[model samples]
Target: MGMTEKQLKSSNKPDKEMPLVQYENVTKKFGDVEVLKGLDLEIKQGEKVALIGPSGSGKTTIIRMLMTLEKPSGGVISLNGEPLWHKKIGDKLVPADEKHLRKLRSDIGMVFQHFNLFPHMTILRNVTEAPIHVLGLSKEEANERAVDMLNKVGLGDKLDAYPEQLSGGQKQRVAIARAVVMHPKVMLFDEVTSALDPELVGEVLQVIRDLAKETDMAMILVTHEMDFARDIADRVVFLHNGQIEEEGHPEDIFETPESERLQGFLSRFLNT
Candidate 1:
């Protein structure tokens, strides 16, 4: 299905009603180079947005910012209508203190391009460790939750295996299980399947597809997998040179691109 008229019109502005995530006039700069420029985007509750573009188009930066791994140089980012990287103190807004930032960021989870697993920990331990320590769950409780998540990701049988014993695909599945055990309100995926072998990519994608089908978490995917993006995303955002150049339903963006830049970008993949 396509975006409603209201959603399309509000694409450049924050929905006053509060989306699950909102970026208003956000900019990011490093030294003299700007990576994102006045970018405004919103993801509604349960919506899945796929960001696609050429390298350095700032797609990954958006997810990194949402994950609180990077901060915007300008503009305000809000999650659930609350400030994310900044806080309002009386009449002025200031950078959020570490404690405030952590509280706000706890609602979000991210899985990266690499399978950043702890080699020394077993799959079960790797998945349970965060919840046991960060969320204050008891070890038994964490392990139970971890087992269920691993089962969902098709890794239940590998719980006792260390990261080094698993294949790259299996490692990524464990990573997904680890993130899901947090029960995040929003999930950020950065080129999640990019590092897998052609045969192994499907297993990882299937786990993500299951999440999209079974959960209500707002998902933002930064990926080069055009076909997967078309199949899984509710909306496709084509970013160009640090701005959202075009966005629409996957069918519209992939089959009937309205911008030459987007058409050119897709042509590279379509022709292959």
Candidate 2:
């Protein structure tokens, strides 16, 4: 069935409004380089977004900010209509303390390209560690949830395996399972398939496709996979020189790009 059909069937949940995430006039800089320039974006709940652009266009940076890994140099970000960088109290933006950020983070998840699994831990342990340490889930509960997640990602039999025993694609899938175990409302994927071998890329992409189909969690992906982005994303955001050059439905962006920079960038990909 189409996404719209599925959306209609799952309409009983509390009204989670659109624009689950918002960046208003956001900017970021690295000394002499301005990575983000007055960027503004609104991402709705359950929207699957693919951010694409030339290298160093700040696609990854945007994900980092959403993950709270990098603070924005200017402007504000909000998640579920609450300030991500600050807490509002009586009309004033107070500095958001770590505790506050931690609470807010329960609604977000991130999966990076380089599967950041603990080398020493078994796959099951790696998956359960966060729930045990951060969310305070009991060992039994965490294990059950971890096993379910691993199975969901097609890693059920590999629970006893360590990171060293898994292939790159397997490791990436495990990382994805780990992130989703928390049932985050928003999932950030930063070039998750970029490091995979060409032959192995499909396995990882398939896993991600399952995730998109199974959950209502919103996802924002930074990726170079143009075809997949076009097929899956509800909207495609193209960043160039740290700014959003153009953004639209995949057909419009890829088939009839209005921006000169976008056309030039796509041309390079075509030549390759």
Candidate 3:
């Protein structure tokens, strides 16, 4: 069966009318260069959003902030309407401490461009470890969940293989399964296919597309693949110079971009 036929099921149904993620005037800077400038974006529960732009456009930084891998220099980010980087201290909001951050981070999962798996662990172990330790699942429970996820990613037969043994696409699918098995409220994909070979990229993308279809978790993908963006996203955001340049339904953003900058940006991908 194809990757699309592999089912990654979720029990939580999303409340689409409510916002799941909010970036309120968020900003990020690395010394002299500001990577994000007063960025404001919201993602509703169960929505799939794609961020597309050139390098250094801050697309990755946005999701990195959401993943808590990078902290913003200004403004607030909220998960489920609660401040992500801040904690409620009596009547005032204070920068979140480790306790504050950890609680919220549990609700988020991120898959990076590189497959950051445990090289020595088998594929099943890599996928099961997090849920077992973090979520406090029994070894038996974690194994069952891991097996189901591995099957869903077309890696069931490769469960005993180590990361070094699997191909790039298969490793990425394992990474995806690892994240999804956590049952996070939000899933972030940061250029997941960028490190894959051209021939292998399709398999990883197909796994992601399958998960996107099955999960109720809000998904934010920072990618350069135009057709993948068109295929998997409900909304496409075009970023330029650390800000959202244009965003709308994929049809509008891909087929009828109003901004010259976006048109030029898409042309490079669409033309060749």
| TM-score for all models, in order of appearance | 0.94, 0.92, 0.93
Query: How would you encode candidate 2's per-residue C-alpha lDDT over 50-166 as one tens digit per residue?
Result: 999999999999989989999988888899889999988899998799988998899999999898889999999999999999999999999999999999888999999999999
Clashes (backbone N, CA, C under 3 Å), per candidate, total: 0, 1, 0
Q: What tens digits encode model 1's per-residue C-alpha lDDT throughout 187-260?
A: 99999988999899999998999899999998999999998999999999999999888888899898889889
Model 3: C-alpha RMSD to truth?
A: 7.5
lDDT of residue 268 for candidate 2: 88
lDDT of each: 0.90, 0.89, 0.89
Evaluated at residue 261, the lDDT of candidate 2 is: 93
Residue-level error in angstroms, candidate 2, position 245: 0.6
**Where is model 2 more than 4 Å wrong at Cα?**
1-18
lDDT per residue (tens digit) for residues 174-241 in model 3: 99999999999999999999999999999999999999998888899999888999999988889999
Task: Between candidates 2 and 3, name the one with more favorable TM-score.
Answer: 3
